[model samples]
Target: MQTVGEVGERAMIALFTAAAAERSDNADDVVIGSGDDAAVLAAGGPVVVSTDTAVAGRHFRFDWSAPEQIGARAVVQSAADIAAMGGALTGLVVSIGCPPATPVDRVLALNEGMVRQTHRLGGRVLGGDLVSAPVVVLTVTSLGSLADLAPVTLSGARAGDVLAVSGPLGGAAAGLAVLSAIEHGADPGLAHRFSALVDRYRLPQPDLTQGPIAARAGAHAMTDVSDGLVEEITTMAGASGLAVDVDSAAVPRPDGLDALAAELGVDPVRWALSGGEDHELLATFAPGDVPPGWTVIGAVGDAGGGPTVDAQPVGDLHGWQSFSET
Candidate 1:
């Protein structure tokens, strides 16, 4: 297999751009596509843009996940920001930096993964830059539009609003724990028994459509659970100038999470509350106006204590912090 150095930067750019163009759907919103100086997009209203970066060793490992999975994960986490704001994905600009010794096929597969995911979420790969670096780094800039709806923000929640989540939680965190255990020489059978959790950690399939649905249902505030449930709610409560009461029993959990947690001697609820990377939308809506697919887990109240689950103060449970050494 040829390395990226063998293909040269110019040829690699051509290859990546071609791959993105082929997978992109014909959309009226995209005026200029890949291989351009900059992408031109037709917007119906204010454009909602977001960017996320994934670094090798930190965000992913080649031995643990395929190039395709890594690529897909990048798009999912990036586009989720658009969804959290009650917008639909329009296009993406992905910048890739990797060592010259990286396999050419790996980079191409990564592009394919991104394009396929973008297409799946109603977006196109517009343009990006490819550079040589010491390790693989993927930066995905996602563009979106809210059409006729107003953009949902973090400070919109009011007292009496109901708090809900779009989908299951803790799966990603649990999956990470399982993968870490396996990497450290745990029984390989654990992989087969907990494949679902493993898959969740590798490639999270968050429902981006729920953001718009929540907005239409009159969500007051919304944010994605990239860090963890407890942390996100704490942020929302602080931003909204109100307190949130989370009913621990109401947060959804992935199937087999209990069993796996038991096997690992960990608390499943802890994982659900503090696990990050699920990318599920956490929003506050008017009571009874909660959308069909969302589960009501709590309610907004007057500010006092920060946030609580089961009416108890949220003490030690926390989410992923980028700067923290823990």
Candidate 2:
């Protein structure tokens, strides 16, 4: 098998550029696609840009996920950020740092995954960088067009607003638990039983369309649930200078999660509240303005307190922290 080192940097660049060109839809916004010094893109309004990274061993294990899944996850991480801002995706710039011994095909496969994801959001791969690193690292920068709409930020929420989520949560957390179990020799059968959860951890499918929908429906504040629900809401509360009350019964959980959690001897709701990486859009809307496809999980209240579930403070709920030890 040919390695990246054997193919050399220039050849790798040529290969990636060709791959991007083949997948490009030639959107009107992308004046110049990949293979250039820098991409030129047209935007009608304010642009929303977000960058995210995935590192080997920490974010993902090569043995646990395919290269395509790794690449797709990176795109999801940044694209969801644009969506949370109520913007339409315009383009993505992806950079990769990998050891020379990494297989050339793996990197190409990774790019293929990113291109496919960008295409789903009506975007193109504009440009990126390649360099040597200790481990395979992917950094994707996603750009979106606001289309003249005001950006929905975490600070826009106010007292008495309805707090909702675009889709189910806890699936990714449940999946991670199952994967950990399998890796530790708990039971190989668990993988077959909970493939959906495993897939969620590998590549989260956030509803990019719902962000704009909520925005149009008058969302006051919005954010993608990259961190756990509790952490995300608390942060939003702090930013907005308000308190939030989450209805424990209203939190959405993926089907069969409770069963899996029971089998694993865990509290499923804990995962729903504290597990992160689901990427579902969480937003605050007026009482009468909550849009379709969103579940009302809580309500915003006055300041001087933190988030609560069942009217009690959430104690020690933890979510993904990049710098914290695993």
Candidate 3:
């Protein structure tokens, strides 16, 4: 086993998990698998289930993201995912893996984060398990109940639907750029410029409340902006075999984004178009207008169609994928 910051927390957990995956028993009563936050059953009333994760090197860094931040972020993100399905969270569970040499306080800090985030989202931790690993990994699962039978789906976008987004864009992209530059040994002054954006990326302001609002507002299709806008728009368009047209000039820029873009030698538009992990909600509506906190960005044109900025093609329809190099 490597000792003392020899490897990132995520790598250690993956190694240990790989070893553990082989030790599974056939008799374990897993109503669901070991991926999402909470498992499900026929104890059913249309439960909303979601899973979120924080890795040592990828999702967060111990040197940057505090232990509590990791826990809170995991819970918030999982809760956001459930809310995307128009479900209100009822409970949370964390499956935590940590190095043996890790400080116990850090673990407590992690749990504290979950509790804080759970309270923020109006939920609580039911129970969970602790395990030994080489690095720190947190996986939070959340369960919610659907008020109505209507569940928002990304694949249900319809042509002529209004394409809209809740909250600002380019912020998370700005933040992630900071983290990546820091990892590459950038100067502290430059990294600090991305602090807010980075925090937004690490602790996303998932539009949990807005999801149901959109669902209730005759939303034809809906999803969170976990991926970049164009990528997500393309995802919905492709799912419905429809085409999307976006007005690049219409997207609202977050504060400090233009300055940050100039500092990083990037286009604010590129960040908005191709950025990922913002977790803002992107929904399609056939109604005449937008709900609160939403901005009109474009319209759905045809099936298998793509976005047009001022009637021009946006960036390549593909957004950044986690395992793929951008």
Q: Which stretches of candidate 1 lie over 4 Å from their true place?
A: none
Model 3 regions more than 4 Å off: 1-44, 183-185, 191-194, 306-317
Residue 214 error, candidate 2, Å: 0.8
Model 3 lDDT-worst window of ten? 18-27
lDDT of 1 by residue, 53-154 (tens): 999988889988889999999999999999999999989899999999999999999988998999999999999999999999999999998989999999
Model 2, span 1-326: residue lDDT tens: 99999999889999889988887755777888888899999877788999999899988888778888888888998999999999888899999999999999999999888888888878888989899998999999999988767899999998889999998899998988998998888888898899988898889997898888888889999999988999998889889889988897799999889999999999999999988999999999999999888999999999876788888988887677999775
Show pairs that collide, candidate 2.
Answer: none
**Full ranking by lDDT:** 1, 2, 3
TM-score of 1: 0.98
What is candidate 1's CA lDDT for residue 9? Answer: 88
- Tens digits of per-residue lDDT, candidate 3, 9-91, equal 45544443333233333313234433335443323477788787777877777787778788877887688787777677766
Estimate the TM-score of every prediction.
0.98, 0.98, 0.82
Q: Model 3 TM-score?
A: 0.82
Full-model lDDT for every candidate: 0.91, 0.89, 0.72
**lDDT (C-alpha) at residue 287 in model 3:** 52
Backbone N/Cα/C clashes per model:
0, 0, 13
List ranges where model 2 is wrong by over 4 Å. Answer: none
